[model samples]
Target: MDRETRLQALSAFLKAKRAKIPPESIGLAPGTRRRTPGLRREEVAQLAGVSTTWYTWLEQGRDIRVSRSVLDSIATALQLNIDERKYLYDLTLESGSGATLWKEESPEISPSLKKIMNELRYCPTIITDRRFFIVGWNEAASCVFLDFEQIPFEQRNMIRLLFARKELRRLAVNWEHFTRGYLAIFRAYYGQYVEDEWYDRFLEEMKRVHPDFDHLWQQSEVKTAPDVLIEFRHAKAGKMMFHLTSLQVQGSADLRCSIYTPDPDSPTENKLKKLMERK
Candidate 1:
């Protein structure tokens, strides 16, 4: 990423984090009315033991040198967790004046990987690249979600489907919850490909199409792959719950396989069986 973009990302992330903190929780009195949510910039500076001007400059994305201690203090003031702290450093510290390493093309799924996906009998599995393009999926996945084969190659992005497809969005019981985590994961990967044309194009299109997406993109939250329990309301099977797990492919760092396995002792397994039978 370029210095300017890196600075902007850092600023956005800091702002977003700051917005989530309540002044009273930090032992500060809830003062007069404010135009926005969370602690003000000056309040953040005070908490971090920095001058208001310096903190303001940082938020303004001004070109200035900052120390590790200051960054640490700011991170603490923002209540950032381990992954978010690492992300803050990645955006501010690792960024330098150089071209980002770009892949010539999207990573292709190897034959073995496809075989592995195909072998997943009961679980719904899907393979995606760094940009979240749906490269392959199993029959169970299609039966539960929309069939990837029906969508055009260019429109097969996971993020896009989550936002734009009404059927899929309706199926996800915790749509907002799932989308926020998904967007954070996407933002984490996006840091590595800020200058890639395809990434930029896809992002722009999403922003244009979905106002909610555009709003959330400004939050600048970053997350690695998530493993969590997700609930779905399938049309044919009623309510179902699964443990969503994501794993990197063995040979390809940029490729990932996400699987949804029915939760133990849940009706999801029986529901999935019925759904598959109907398929």
Candidate 2:
């Protein structure tokens, strides 16, 4: 949708949703002789902890910059569900303002590059685009975590896998901690392509399928590329510790290669070796 139309729809949608919430529902007195059926513009602004003028401007469809935090507050105040909240973001956040963070076409992995990834027998390595779509992975990666080759291409997303896949959750020793960091990085990446179709669809599908994602997403956390120690509980290998490293592919700025190396001093190294031997 064009910017103007998006803004207009945002204004209308907010007003409609706002009207559905009663003052009594939020522990506010329903003042007598109310001209409107629901809360007033000022009430919404007050509840959302934003300025009345700013809320008014938004309701009027003014071309004002909206932050994710502010949108979260407004959505909360309006009692918006996941779908509505997503719609609010899509409408208010104009896509034209941000730089294109993703390529129009997915990058192809050369046979040589694929071979190199596979040759990293000791390190579990996987390649993904900016959007976290798995482009390629080494056998060690499959042995360590999931066999991405078995998953459908459309569902081969790190974020989606983390949120929607039960096996990954079970495998992670620190699932919550790991996901928080992972999501923060994902959110930071998402900011670069808030208006992109792939992002839009990804957000919608995630929110629809994983209820927890919406709550976490609304937190608006952000983090840059991170290096940390991760522990995974493999059914066959037991608990394994790895130092994770994320690096940008040399020529493909949009693509990244993540390698997990077993801690040299820890038993994780021996465990990985045995896992590879078994494979």
Candidate 3:
């Protein structure tokens, strides 16, 4: 993990990924027919405020020194999060540069949250930590979560579920759109606290359990709180639509409450009510 060549490989990979980002994506209009498929070297150079030669060397995996200012500029230009930025630092740092020590914290959902889950058994709600760990969930969330009691409590991660569960993929009406935001939320939360071993463990599990997620993560496409839309085949109301609303806990910084809502005038509301009434 602390190898120079490995860091170089990561840098080269970033350079390649950055090269494909279109100027239009960053509000810079495409000027004319270009040789490259994505943004030109000079375009990123101008935005990043570094010599084209240095950035070129960075892309080529050549030896060059990086300044904090320039690195920050590049991070902003590439829209890298704390993890991705840390990865960049890891890649560019000299061997034995001493990486930031990642710590392990409980960040578990509170007992009150557990009680709330029990009381709100009618709604499919979950109480997760900053790292998206499912510390508390109701029977309703379990039903929606699709196998709550079976999966290891530690392995009950939202990102892992999106990739590992066949029902989550097949049953979710708009999987691609819904799943895209999970990483965004993950990245955004992990950005604030990068030293969590649990976060790394979750990441490792994601890479091992789901190759598709691994590929996307490697692309360094960090998402920052995206609106999530999940559709379901309701037992009573037929097809349904659900949107998750996230809110930070008032006192505890680590916890967040995510409530699922049905689209207005949609069958999902009625279906949810029927499901609740049955139990």
**Number of the top lDDT candidate:** 1
**Per-residue accuracy of model 1 over 136-201 as CA lDDT, tens digit each:** 899999999998999987789899999989988899898988788778877776665555545566
lDDT per residue as tens, model 2, 198-244? 65667788899998887766554455566899988999999889898
Candidate 3 regions with alpha-carbon error over 4 angstroms? 1-20, 24-36, 57-68, 75-108, 111-123, 189-193, 196-205, 234-237, 250-253
All candidates: CA RMSD (Å): 2.6, 8.5, 4.9
Please report the candidate that would top TM-score against the real structure. Answer: 1
Clashes of 2: 0
lDDT of 3 at 204: 72
* Candidate with better TM-score, 1 vs 2: 1
lDDT of each: 0.82, 0.78, 0.64
- Regions of candidate 1 where Cα sits further than 4 Å from its true position: 95-104, 195-197, 250-252
lDDT of the structure predicted as candidate 3: 0.64
Candidate 1 Cα deviation (angstroms), residue 20: 0.2
Candidate 3 lDDT tens digits, 146-250: 657687866777777778778778766777667766665665554344334455656776778677876666544554444466687644446878777766676
Ranking by TM-score: 1, 3, 2
> Can you rank all candidates by lDDT, best first?
1, 2, 3
TM-score of each: 0.88, 0.65, 0.71
Worst 10 residues of 2 by lDDT: 95-104
